[model samples]
Target: MSPPDRKEAEVRRMLDGPHPLVPPGLGLRAAVRGRRLLLWRRRLGLAGWLLFLAAVAFTVWAVTQQPWIPPPSRTTPPLEGW
Candidate 1:
């Protein structure tokens, strides 16, 4: 037989064979893992939003306060003459 036909026959034979055994608890374990993954993703998303808000708040405060400018002198300059 041709290589293609041989491959097809081999595949058909494998499909006709009995299926492998699966663990009884596989579905329960998968469900628990899926729930944990969803919770972790939600927590990560909330933390990302909180960090973004904090950064925006800090930027706004800095702009309004203008902390870079020096404070005014407390006392007046000395007299020019005695």
Candidate 2:
């Protein structure tokens, strides 16, 4: 094709915008939508994150709140001192 025709075609393509899911379209939209759906389903993602945090907190609390216990060897007699 002629130079002018080619340039015109290029400009037209640039202005035509991209196709979705199959061509040069905004794939980011799909990703964003997926994220939004996830957030929506999970109640704005905050609840999910808070739940995760709560699980971690519960685990830590359970571990740390336990009473201390000495080693078995320390609590046991040393074989009647040989």
Q: In model 2, where do residues sit more than 4 Å from their true spots?
A: 1-44, 67-82
lDDT of each: 0.95, 0.79
TM-score of 1: 0.77
What are the per-residue Cα lDDT tens digits for candidate 2 across 22-69? 655569888899998987988957888999999999889879876465
Q: 1-82 in candidate 1: lDDT tens per residue?
A: 5466888899999999998999999999999999999999999999999999999999999999988998899999999978
lDDT (0-100) at residue 69 of candidate 2?
58
**Model 1 regions more than 4 Å off:** 1-8
Could you tell me the C-alpha RMSD of candidate 2 in Å?
Answer: 8.9
Worst 10 residues of 2 by lDDT: 69-78
